[model samples]
Target: MPEFKQFLLADTAEGLTEAEILSVRVQPGDEVTVNQVVCEVETAKAAVELPIPWAGKVTEILVEPGQTVEVGAPILTVDVDPAGGASVNGSAPAAEEEMKPLVGYGSKTVTTKRRARREVTPEAPVTKGGYVPLAKPPVRKLAKELGVDLRALATSVDGVITREDVQRAAAPAAPTAPAAAPVSSGARERRVPIKGVRKATAQAMVSSAFTAPHVTEFLTVDVTPMMELREKLKKHPSFAGVKLTPLAFAAKAVCLAVKRTPDVNASWDEAAGEIVYKDYVHLGIAAATPRGLVVPKIRDADAMSLAELAAALEQLTTTAREGKTPPADMLGGTITITNVGVFGVDTGTPIINPGESAILAFGAIKDMPWVVDGQLAVRKVLQLALSFDHRLVDGQQGSQFLADVGAILADPAMAITY
Candidate 1:
């Protein structure tokens, strides 16, 4: 007789209430091993893979893809003793007195309760007047919008209908109109659900903007020397295989500037009624991802060499773009930098990220006419804007920090003197 066991979705981190199932890897009757990835789920912070605890043949999957499930909900069931063939005698093996723990089981103690099974009939089509098909609410809405009858469409999986099924049914109707037809004629407005990383970012921005009093200061500097230095570093052996951008130099400048103005590297603790100053710098780089804007931190960025900082930035952006950044990496940031230059835009007043006192915006560098040594010449000019929390940082400190950053860019050699 085969023994059956159930697996629940454990909370991956504290304060995580739920996660949406992105993909299901295993199905009924498929054998799996312990610690094998069973599915992928997306929380508010990031997407994570869930593994099964017991090695067995899958008996049933309770949750479908695109469905949001709460923590501690049963996701699937498996038969631990598949070779016993318990179905031949129409009887299941007796429940074990003690069960092994799974990866997602957490530290909580497990309790078992048995209940009699009840038989369920298959859902009938709308014409037969039995019941509607098993489709999620969002999928049902999409099917209605596309004029697709859920019961009339064929599904690859048993017992459930999916969004893909509706899309396939609707694809045949698209060619009725001309390919060049305007989309606005069909649907004037499209709505997207705000959740996951986007939702968290929105809430954080709102909180930060309202709670903190922001003061922005802008500075324009000639960065011709900085650009020339980058060209020289390209030929250096230590910079081989590293893509050195102006952001790397700006990051180093900020790290050094913080030492002169340590208040910028502190956070205001509202609950404790205190301002916390950090000794080590956990620098944050704001990267725009397909999902949304995410700030992943570089641990001890102040101590890293130029080459090391470039490498860390490369890995951080790659992980963020792939939506694989973990929640732990997104916390405990001391300062941040947003490179608006990548979008070819000038500086703007950026809101401080929650828990951080200051943020710097690096603007696009352009070649323009400037007076150098009382003579007109074309030089690389760039703009920098610094936004700080008025509660912790004053005008004098903010201006000095921005000035130091500008001086470093104006002359890369000033980094050594400062």
Candidate 2:
């Protein structure tokens, strides 16, 4: 007979006092292996899938889905054997319980009061230190979104933790008390509950805003030719059902512009005291969804054809809006582009996405007076704003990238020249 091993949910990061078990993919008596995704736990940032630390037989699932549990809490129990063979007496090593692998935050055996009133009756809810667990407002908000009940949690006896508990709190919530209802209504701002990826984005944005010195530059370009080319392309048989807009051209121009200017395709590495330039392009498209603003990058956008890029963009936007974007797809971008023009706006000083060097904002393309053939003529024009890290890219390099993009939009024929 082989000695048993028990697996646990190890702490992934700090400041995570409690977690909401979003889903349990594995059940008791199920055979599991190392690196197998057993469950997904929702922290304040995003829901992360936790892999089984070591291989074993899942003896019991200690937690339920949608249950809020503190960090270091027991999530599951697994039975394991040393070398897959012997009992503790023979080939198995000494029972060093604390030396268990992935038995999360280390294991502790506790003796609980056995049920005596169990003549076919439900047992009382478990409480910690003779008091029900209590969480603060923000924690409560997170638990609510994760479908957790604070009253069902187990906390220390002294319920000293209140709404004013500052440490370990990250979620931002605007109070919706009845007295403040009038002001909220007057602003007409929809109070979207912050959770999931949106909450993570909020934290990143705040950190970036305060950490980085954001500088934005704006330019106006005549994109009449680009718009015309889009119309012409749509008439082609292959482009049927594909909405060809100036954005597709803009994205292509950005890719070309990046080749000319590598610094724009770089990131500021503060700790390393260097600017890291990427050889490839992970172009991000900033899309506005009902959930929030999500920038789903089309990996290796430089290699994709016009048709492929358009299709990719369409799919990315659709998935983002439906909140079906996978965690892997949301990261690793070199640069970003936002189409503010769709909302009928004309240019804005957009903020750079965190970790990336630059972000381009495309304004509405409208008919305006322009100098075509050195004469004042009415032509379709668009404004472009390039926001870059000054530390990484100087004005000269930034201006050149913007100019290249503008030139492409000014005359789609220039795309052939390049």
Candidate 3:
């Protein structure tokens, strides 16, 4: 005898209500170990890998990739030895009474789905010859989502209708050659469903744009000294293997400038009727990934040395681009920096993140003619744009913060005195 058990989808991160299935790592009949990654899911915050708690034969995969599931919903099922295999993961598996029911499933008779060959219900209409479509619950759900009628295909492919059957049936009708003239080939338009990180980022941007009263200020600075120092540091023995990028320098400058003008590191609490000023700076560096735009933070950036900030920046950007940034790393950011310069763009008014008071857009650095003490010379120049919430930061504070950052970048020596 074999005991069947279901492993429900738990919230991977705090406050996560739903997640989209990125991929399924195991198939039916596959042996799995405890704490092994069973699947990957993308929540609003970040992409996360979910591990299975049970070590047994995977009996079923209840969800398909591209499907979004609510927390506590059944995701997978496994079969364990019935005689005494209850302690698959050490202590006796969590009792059925301990599992929390899926949200919105109140008082509904919960039942596990069985193999399609088991039985057909009366509600399921039978075809002309009493042939009821045999498909698992997950396949049926997929068919419904794609607007495919399983009954119409009752001339059943084989025995049980599978995921591929539903997909093949749902595909658009092939373009036929016209009798009068040959029809043109290929689809000109492409449509992609917006459901994952892109969808979440859109909603967040909309909310931030409407909720926060934004004011953007721009400042152009001569960074000849900064660029010169970068070259000198690269040759130094201490900076071996360090990525001393302009973005890293900008991040360090932002952290230092925050100490002189703390308003940029504060947030407005409408409900609490107060301004929340943070003593420690959690600097967020916006990185664009293949999935979408994500801002991963460097904690207590103000306390980190320049070398440490550069190392953290390199690691953070690499992880983010690989889509492995943890959900927790993307939260609780006090201030943000978007390096538009990476794309060779000058500058733009960037939108502030929801919980943060301000965001700085670092532009591309290039050679420009400048008046240095009544002398015209070619200097490395870059533009900086700071967008802040008007309710939390005023014009004077924002200008001061921008000026302080520019001063440090123009002359690294100023950082020592500050």
Candidate 4:
């Protein structure tokens, strides 16, 4: 007789009610060790890896990938004493005292790893014109962008193509013809199942747009001084290893501007009939990931120096792009910034993120002719737009806040006075 133990989904973090099973790493009869990740799940905020607590052979998997399960639900069962001779009730004496706690269950450190996927049958080899390559979607997209034909690469590693293979193939590449357009002949309408992050984002956006009265204000400024400062900072010892960009300056400006206009860092509490003003700022940076838009916050952003802010932004964006941002980092945001300029587009009216009163949109920076005193010269210029909850932030406050941000960007020295 073997003692079976059930592994329930523990509360991974605060405010997480349920998660969608992204992948199942183990199956029945597989031997697993304690703390080994058994599956991955995606919550409304971030994707998380769940580790099994008991070491044993898997007896059964209760949940499948893509199915949402609530916290405390039994996800899998394991036989602790697979060699037999255990209590009939499946209780191993002293099991509780011998088990080690799983890391990151309630801590800031997050563990994320995927087990090696089971190999699939090798597809047919490539001919000249009709060969399909073995690669993930992102790897294929990279190959297409780099003008490397995946069919040309030799599949020596488990008959699968990887990102490194695509990069190596593109290393000594010459100019190649544009990729042929994808040909399709069928009904144009396609129905995409809206679930996971996409579904949550759609619902939040709809609610915010309808519930909050939005007001947008725009300002155009000469950012020549800010650009010059960035170039100088890059060579400075204190700023070494920091990838400072216009966004950093914009972030710092928002922090300082919020001090002057606290309403921008507030939330409208209609049910309570009170406006909640946040004394501290958890600055949110909106990142467009493969899944959808995710805004991960930098905690206590107003207290950080320029270098610290830059590093925080870099880490936040990287985590988001890799689809590993923890759900805790996506909550409690006081205000947000969206850089549409990265895509080479000018500013647009951005909607306020739910729970936050204001959002800023940074537009493309361009060199254009401008009047300096009485002389015309080409200068770095930027367009900025701020959207706010009109109920909390009136037109006057919105204008002042946007103007202050523009002023700081136009002249970095003004930040000291602010």
- Which lDDT values do the candidates have, in the order given? 0.82, 0.71, 0.81, 0.82
User: TM-score of predicted model 4?
Assistant: 0.75
**Deviation of model 1 at 213, angstroms:** 1.4
Query: Scored by Cα lDDT, where does model 1 land?
Result: 0.82
Q: Provide the global lDDT of candidate 2 against the true structure.
A: 0.71
RMSD of 1: 12.2
lDDT of 4: 0.82
Model 3, residue pairs in steric clash: none
RMSD of 2: 12.0
Question: What does candidate 4's lDDT look like per residue over 333-378, in tens digits?
Answer: 9999999999998899998998899999999999999999999999
Q: What lDDT does model 3 reach? A: 0.81
Q: 2 or 4: which has the higher TM-score?
A: 4
TM-score for candidate 1 = 0.76
Which digits, one per residue and each the tens of the lDDT, describe model 1 over residues 7-124?
7776676456568899999988788998999999988778889888888888888899889886556677778888878432233323433344448546554533322322223453
Off by over 4 Å in 3: 1-3, 80-97, 100-186
